[model samples]
Target: MSETYLIDRATVLTMDGATGATPVERSIRVHDGEIVAVAGALDPQPDDVVLSGRDRLVVPGYVNAHTHSWEALFRARLDNLPLEHWMLLSYPVLGLAPLSPDLIRLRSQLVAIESLRNGVTTLVDDVLEIPGQTEDQLAAVFEAYRDSGIRANISGHVMDRPFADHFPFLADALDADLRRQLDAVTVVRGDEYLDYARGSAQRYADYAGGRLRFMLGPSAPQRCSPDLLAGIDEIAATYDLEFHIHVLETRTQAVTGAEFYGKTMVEYLDALGVLNERVTMAHGIWVTDSDVEVLADRRASVSHNPISNLKLGSGIAPWRKYLDAGVNLGIGTDGMSSSDTARMSEAVKAAALLHKVTGPDYRQWPTAQEVLTAGTLGGARSARLGDTVGSVEVGKRADLVFYDMNSLAFTPRNKPELHLVYSENGSSIDTVMVDGRIVVRDGRVTSVDERAVLDELQARGPELRRWQDELETLNRALLPAFDRQYASVMARQVAVDRYSGRGECWLN
Candidate 1:
């Protein structure tokens, strides 16, 4: 049993969701990894360990709704590429490389450390290509999460094709034999994928006492056939698990799907009976008003990755449309290769600014407090872990972060919540506790040897880069043929000026 701990003298932001309120100075009591009570000043029990929290803001740890930790090694490689080119050029290269279990574990550990330092206690890792890649290699990732002492919802990527048809360049770049190999690649059936995911989740759930959960991650409408999507939905229903899928990320995707299926991607998924409360779609940037209405009607959640969308030249998501339509909305850092950073506070600020610039009036924009709530509670809700870990309160897991108030950025703190969302960054986080355990203290990770991990990653990262570069060179060698094929396909498929009136396309 964990010992009782008393965290005193801090401004506690309960985030109970009843009101958009400020943090109250109070003491929090934790026992057996659960918050037992919170008061203005709780008396420490005989067995309680008292921790000083002077001049600090204590709030529930941030939840990262969408992420791909393996992409950390591919940082700075996909810069300046459009959405289609980036995926076509980068994903296949990274996916084909020989990443050892040690390297995979190391990369995941680095990502966990980055999140811990930023006060993110929970992560939803959207992992693909785990089956062909050895089980031991995948287990290494789980081990890293355990060692980091953070909760995770790990999903195995289930895709039938190596590259979807939406990626015309990559599709056209494949030679006849390579194309056959890509077509011959078979993913685990939805039932089989669920079995693997459940086994992994149960192992980690028992090991960490339910700190880890599994979700059904269908690799989007384009990558998945109708039968596969339906199978995934049925499996999720059978296991009572949450489901995640990438939806309507680019105009190209929407256009391609419309041309193929005579409906938008969201409509296609809906026809297959995949949209539901248990489903969360990442990057609904191309969603139409009717799509938003369907999502709201079905009570499905959407994760808005503002940084990633902007970085990939994907258009801005209709934040006001989702919010006004009563759709559940959350925030995510899509992946390291796309977003370049995993800082949630920065995401919050970007969300606010994105809305302000896109909306009809700046005065009616989402405030810092509202964006912070979306990052915290809304994100947890999207992951279906809201009741347990989203907020600070009695009967909830004691996943909390303590930020030092003495930072130069927060010197003249008029409003702690506002300053936290708007002015502060990860450096202000002095301590991070997940499930009542201090995973990070004094601005350093405690569960793993972070410096050693960084050293190993830095040493071995070049080899990974070499492998990636080799793949890129192979692809570049075939670029001329690919360019001609892409031109023909775009001329026949892509709809130019479809979004001509949708504001100045500030995303680019």
Candidate 2:
């Protein structure tokens, strides 16, 4: 049995759906990785560890609802590029550098520590699998999470469609050699991926004191074939797993869905019979009112990546519409390369402020409290861990973040939620505990050699970028063709527009 711990006199923001709205002073007790008692605690064990919670704001640990942790190695390296250029040009080059289990593990370790430092206790890693990587390489990822003392849910990203086919006019516009090159990109069968999923689920289902979970990840709606999407849904049902997929992220994607399926991707998923409660769609930026209704009707959740959406020039999500429609809204940081940071605080703040410009009506703006809920409980729902770790309750796991209320971010401390969402950017996060264990203290990780990890990465990152010249050569060769394709996609008017200045062209 583990020793009990007491967090005394904390200004606890329970983050529990039942009690998160109002912050209260209370003491919390934890034993065996679960929060046992939450208030009016009378007795204390002789061996118990009592921690002073004064000057601290104890909230539920932040959840990185959606992430591509493997991209941590290349974080911020491809900044200043939109999603189109990032995916089509910058990222594909990483495929040519090198593949090693050590690199994967190191990257995962780096991301896990970064999350903890930013007050995140859990991560939903939409791990973009490097093609032809062995199971051992994948195991290294899980091992790093376990060793880092952070909870993580991992899924190997599945994408069968060639990169050339992901766009509308790319194949037709590219030269024969470039077309052949893109078409020859790595491919894998749907069944093979499911087979791997089954084995992976069993292999690491209970790692890190039962903190690891494996899920099915379809890369996206248009990038995945119908057979693969349906097959993935079936496999999820058979195994009782959650599926994470990207949908309607960019305006161009809205066009792709209509051109590919004669409807929105949301409707296509519904028709394909895969739109259900177990699905978590990331970035529903261009979703129509009808699409929101469909998602709500299916009881699905959407991972709101506000910072990433803004950074990539993807339009703002109709979060107010989604809330009114009763769709579960979870906040996420997307990928390290996408947002260049995995800080939930930044995402929460962006969600609170970015939607204000959509209209002047103040009644529909996202509330700071709501964004806080999304960063906590809503994220748990997205990760399918709602029952276990989202909230601070008697039966829930003890995943708590200790923010310094004494910091400059909270100097006056008049409005905790408002200041948290609009001002703080994780500089106030002093310590974080996961599963009742003190994994982080005084802004340093307690369980891993973080400096050594940094050293290894610095030593190895240059080698991975050894093919920069070759990548530049290839990008130059394809940029013009890709530029044409981009223009064609952008010009192909869709039935809806989610951007601010690009409202529908009235033809009536």
Candidate 3:
């Protein structure tokens, strides 16, 4: 049955695009799942649920613009590694193995719980573990999101190549059974990728009644061929869905793309007609000024994952460039394994501070308000849900977070917005509401058995770790053979270079 709730006497930070400039302290009345009123004159009805907002600040619930929730269970396992090595050493070890559906479901639940507890109501996660493992595994993830009382945009990861060419040792170490499973699977490309994305969207659209959305993630330019990318864009447009892809995450990727495609990665994608308003590019760490201009021209969005970039030693993203170019931007934690935490408030501060370090003048640094907007509204914009979910306002979904203003972090708060961005972390989130329902109250999640989820995560950690360790050891053992194979390839390349009279610079 539908219900009505009135949250009164709160200083609301209505991030509404129309009302962002002037937010007033008022009572918000939510009917069913949508906000019906935001005024002082409304009288409470007899059956309405009234929540007191004494000494609390109400703001829009955070939107985690991007994540890889499947990596949540693998946190802290690959710390202190460079970006290339992290992907080389950790991706296969953590992702390529045959994980039980139970483990995947548990990990998704843990990740969703972490997000909800921290005041994040929506997540657009890139779950690209293994191709064709999408059906039951993805359903399990959606079930976790539903049970956790969070909204999500989930997509299966698609890759078109065997690991041997990229991570030779990792490929060779895969058992015949695993190899057969991988090889026999049909690659998601062209119409296949489109069909999968559209089907998933329709299914989840029905499941959420439009609450839980689905997106088309093409993995990245390197992982996807041109035909697949074009098809993905077409599919998203046809279905009116959001499109996500990784771009310019590292210099190696950019250099490789330029060398292979005779154009920059962004330019290549632009030529393929994949850049548009509906597209959100994750990472974008190594984007050039021209690239930023192209994105701006296309009205595309950029997801700034400051912690993940720093953790992996990827260069800081050009936040100022994007802002100057008028590119819509948002904040993300990337993934638990890459970020080690799912705290969006910390991510907001990181975004502000990272720009301060890279920019020439501190005065030009991103402000707390700007960072907060990026985390909430910008993320909503990236997900194409800006009008509905990003802000606290009348006639919108009642997605909000309540922070205890009495906390030490917010003591004598001169600027509540500043305190939220720079001082208050997730611990200050006293209550969280999504779709007018209180999913978290008094810092405790109300939807799931928190202790049992924690216990399951703890119990499952060791087995996953053991499997990862075994895979790493096997990869190490096969490294010598891979080295020989690489040497052979290099020798052949050198011979071709010599015959062509291109000399040492030929490879470059």
TM-scores of the models, in the order given: 0.91, 0.96, 0.88
Poorly placed runs, candidate 3 (over 4 Å): 18-23, 93-95, 162-191, 476-508
**What lDDT tens digits, residue by residue, belong to model 3 across residues 316-422?**
77777788789999999998888988778778888878777653677778877678889999999999888789887677788889889899878987788888877
Best by lDDT: 2
Name the better of 1 and 2 by lDDT: 2
Please name the candidate that would achieve the greatest TM-score relative to the true structure: 2
lDDT of each residue in 1-508, candidate 2, tens digit only: 3968888888888877666846778789989889999994436668679888888888998888888886686666676656877774445633364457787889899998889988899899988755644687778888899889898888877887877778777777889988777666677777787788778777766767678888889999888889999888987887667799999998778878888889989999999999998999999888878898999999999999988888788887888888989999899999887888888888888888888888888897888778988999998988888988878889999999988999999988887777778878888888888988889989899979999999998887677576544665566677777678778887787766677723443221
Models sorted by lDDT, best on top = 2, 1, 3
How many pairs collide in each candidate, listed in order?
0, 0, 1
Q: What lDDT, from 0 to 1, does candidate 3 have?
A: 0.76
Clashing pairs in 2: none
Order of models, best TM-score first: 2, 1, 3
Clashing pairs in 1: none
Q: How accurate is candidate 2 locally (lDDT)?
A: 0.82
